[model samples]
Target chain A: MACGRPKLRVGPSQREGGFTDSVPATVSRMENQSMRITALIVCLPLCAFGAATAQGLLLQRAGSQAENRPVIPKASKGDQCVADTEIMRKDHMSLLNHQRDETVIEGIRSEPYSLVSCVNCHAQTDTSGQAIRIDAEGQFCESCHSYAAVKIDCFTCHAAKPAAMEVIGNAEPHLMRDNPHTLVSYLLNKEANE
Target chain B: MSRVPVADNEKSLQARRRFLQGLGLAGMASMSYSLLEVKAKTPASSDKRWGLLIETEKCSSGCDACVRGCNEEHGIDDAGDDLTRAQWIRKIDLKDELTGNETSLPVMCQHCESAPCVDVCPTGASFKRADGVVLVNKHTCIGCRYCMMACPYKARSFIHETLTEQKPSAPRGKGTVESCTLCVHRIDEEQDRQPACAVKCTEEAHSAITFGDLNDPDSSISQKLNTLGGSQIRADLQLNTGVRYQGL
Candidate 1:
């Protein structure tokens, strides 16, 4: 209300110029304040943008933990995969899907991409020598599938381990052991007694 | 070596003709031997079509050796009721009304050339292998039971409950359709061994069921079919079933 100069009466700088000075000390102080306000207005958004960029980088680093990495099993026979590592990582599911159709519809059992062959090579065992099922944590198929958030329905109807080692201590060794036809001969012998 | 000099044109021409005749004879001998080898190896093809022949007259009414063998091979846990149980193979008792003639025989999947179950399957889970063995790929099965409805022999069964400790060769689980695979795992693994049912029946002295390659003219089933002539059940359907019955 007082011509926007309310601090004029209380200022020592006002005494230096008195009434003769056109540009008063109070006006200069006001200008300084306006400059500070303009600087603050310009710098605040830039500071926020910098902080946001730093936060995004931190999140990305946290997301790349070992739990999120693909769990590729160590090959028993050779160091290399059937396909290149990058190709297998990208297109394994599609390859398996195509192989399933070939095996089921066309009866082409000689393909190298069979799921049973995969299980034979990749299935691991615990310290106790018991087979780790496909759904178990840290297992080859489950670990990668869980990391990628994909549901696996293969173990529902297919064995997760090799045929020979699956029934190790069982009485019916012929069911899945090395000699697959032993059961037929056993049954034949049993029926001979009857 | 000593060489006798003769007339230039006549001797050289005679030598050339003998050399050509010798080459032709060698080629003919090799071709004839290769043809004989091919004929001899026809029975050993992996693509050979496998089938079963059942002699119904020789099958005993009460003996369940084949059924027991199949159940043991697959680890089929016995359910409380017949309707809920999983039966891969079963004994069927047939009677003719007019003649009052009765016979008992074991029955399972016929492995049709054009399977109705394969035709009606929504997921193409029911399929016939190149070797004429019909099988159900349970991974693609959605428990829709369409295959079960389309099967003429009621060979397929749906698992209503979860199963554990399954055989590695036969991984059965809940909510899928399964059926007789004709012991395909055994067939794939062993060259000389027959199916469990056939072996059991033969050892039990019934000798009613015979398993062999249908494509091989020298196979036992083919020779028997040639002499005794077999009949296919529901031949009117034109399924051309792999399993044939003698003395039906």
Candidate 2:
């Protein structure tokens, strides 16, 4: 007098034959949950490891190709720079921003850090010997900025190329001379000879 | 042989003494030169307040040499039509109300002591340098034309179109208000060099504009202003402009 179906009686030998009639329902449920937990624990680390290894390989492959990396131009003044390459590569924007304030606001137009000075040194020329614009592709500023996915708007208001000639009638006559440091050197040498 | 060594020692001692003396002299000279340089360059403490004295009597009725010079200096010759043109300086003709005679004079940013344009700028992009030269910092200018509206003389202009081939000394661009900077680049580089307009005027033999320090009594412009009593364009505003006009 079962509710729906009549229960068929099986021998005790058939208990391990994938029949859960003798096993407690609670024990079976717990076993299923434990199996799921074990699967997740085993699979999670394996998936993560796989993803990380794949990413590492991709990065290594990209790194091996020069085209994937940013091309920094050789400095006109050999390896001399206002700052160390590592520091400049990381924090150049901040330094330039601070320098802009100093030059524009305070009127401190010192060399090697000024925008004009940077253009004088870093501005590159094509085969025709004309200076390239700052925002041109493959140019010194654009190449690095584009590779880093940064947008630079400095060339919009600033001259992208170095001035062909220095502005006329500089206040310091010595500075205008062909050999600017000659006077200082001469003085030093005269002192040495004396 | 012993006497020869003695002589050599004496000679070396004399050379060392002379070297020390020369070093002392050079140090003194450099120290003095540096002191002079500081006095000359320091805008705050300097007794030289730069100004322009424009003798309207000498200004020709139709000549625009000053304006042309300014245009060439700033590379604004190609600035498009009348409305969008960057007019650093302009020649304006005025008819006398009583005399029925027409006179012309060059007008530009007066470089006021208490500039309203500087006051109204939200970002302080419009600023007066320590030398009293009013200039716009294009880096901070947000294309807000508050300075243009605030100017009493209508001296400022907003660049509407993109600029190209700008002079290296004058870095102007689109979306920024600009006005006469009194050739600040030249002033910074050369104390003796006049503003382009003044130079052009002299070259043309008009000699209408004279540029010199107002603070120094010995300066030619100061002497002329003191004796001739020049007038500011908007004297009612009490702006105390650096540029002054005579025979207006």
Candidate 3:
């Protein structure tokens, strides 16, 4: 009745008949049962050792491929970030959220935790010195975010590059419309169309 | 032309006269007289209500400089069809049916003190700032369009398509209702405060729009409003809109 099935108590003679093929027929029933228990104990460690070795090999392979990890770009502006690197890595979302509320809701724009500042410092440049967007493929934000499988929603509305970055052949004045957001792409497409 | 008759009552006139007299004394003393001296990097305070006064008589009907300036400023002209494109500011032509007189003015968000948009927003996205700038917090906005329905002036526009090349200062995207921010970014950033439309209007030589703190009696907008008189669109609603029109 233990486990919803009738637990029939097998006698030593019944066990002896059941184990006759596996255990030697001349061996005593007590000795046979003890040897079976010994075998079970020995198999457990062997299975665990095999699994441990497999895990160790995986760890070694991963460690050797360290260069495959996300490459964080150096900040172009300040010597250091507004916060420590480790702190920024962990708490940048909360910091940006706090600053967003202050700037957007309260109309306080001077704080250093702004997304614009992050782009100004972190955005990279191309061969001809045109600023590359931080969220573009293999770029600053994308490197880590794509590796971590985290989707960035900020650049959907916010510019991914600094506003002052110059795009080649754009004759427009450096006004708000000339910001390096879609304007660069828009002008480039227009140039292509022409 | 209809006049709003603001501060026209005997008691209000007496209070305004006393304020002007005090301002005159303060100005004569050369103490850099200002009700609220705004500093850099600070949140806008309730003490100063930012507003605009558009002289309709001066606003030229054919000119779309203000509209163009506003669109360029916010990066709203890049995409979307004419039917769905967001218009933060628009030039409206008004004609007096009986007298055959015509008036032209730029219309945008009125930034009402008791904003219907602020009232109807289910997610509290439409809110009035401390300085009385009604704004839509797109982060909280669910694109319900309830605020658009409630608004009397038809100020707000719903962004329909995915936007690109958004300005760093004005971050607009699809699935959120937006309106004229009254150039809140310029007011916050630049030392010389003027919305893009106002700046463009001035650049175009119309100089029809005047932006200043309505609470400051010494401010040009309030002073001009006090003397020349101004009227709000749909004044019967009593929203007490921050944007006013003169010679309407």
Interface RMSD of each: 13.0, 10.2, 9.8
Clashing pairs in 3: A182-B165
Across residues A43-156, which tens digit of lDDT does each residue of candidate 2 receive?
999999999999999998988866678787875433455667776688567657754654565454432345665665677888987777766888788888998889988887
DockQ of 2: 0.12
Each model's Cα RMSD = 19.6, 17.7, 12.4
lDDT of each: 0.71, 0.73, 0.78
lDDT of 1 by residue, A85-179 (tens): 67677868865776565445444444455676677557776789766675678778887888889999778666666554323444344543343
TM-scores for every candidate against the unseen true structure: 0.67, 0.73, 0.76
- Candidate 3, residue B168: CA error in Å? 0.8
TM-score of chain B of each: 0.80, 0.81, 0.82
Residue A127 lDDT (model 2):
90
In TM-score terms, which candidate is top? 3
lDDT of 1: 0.71
Interface DockQ of each model: 0.10, 0.12, 0.24
Worst 10 contiguous positions by lDDT, candidate 2 chain A: A177-186
Q: Candidate 3, B196: how far from true, in Å?
A: 0.7
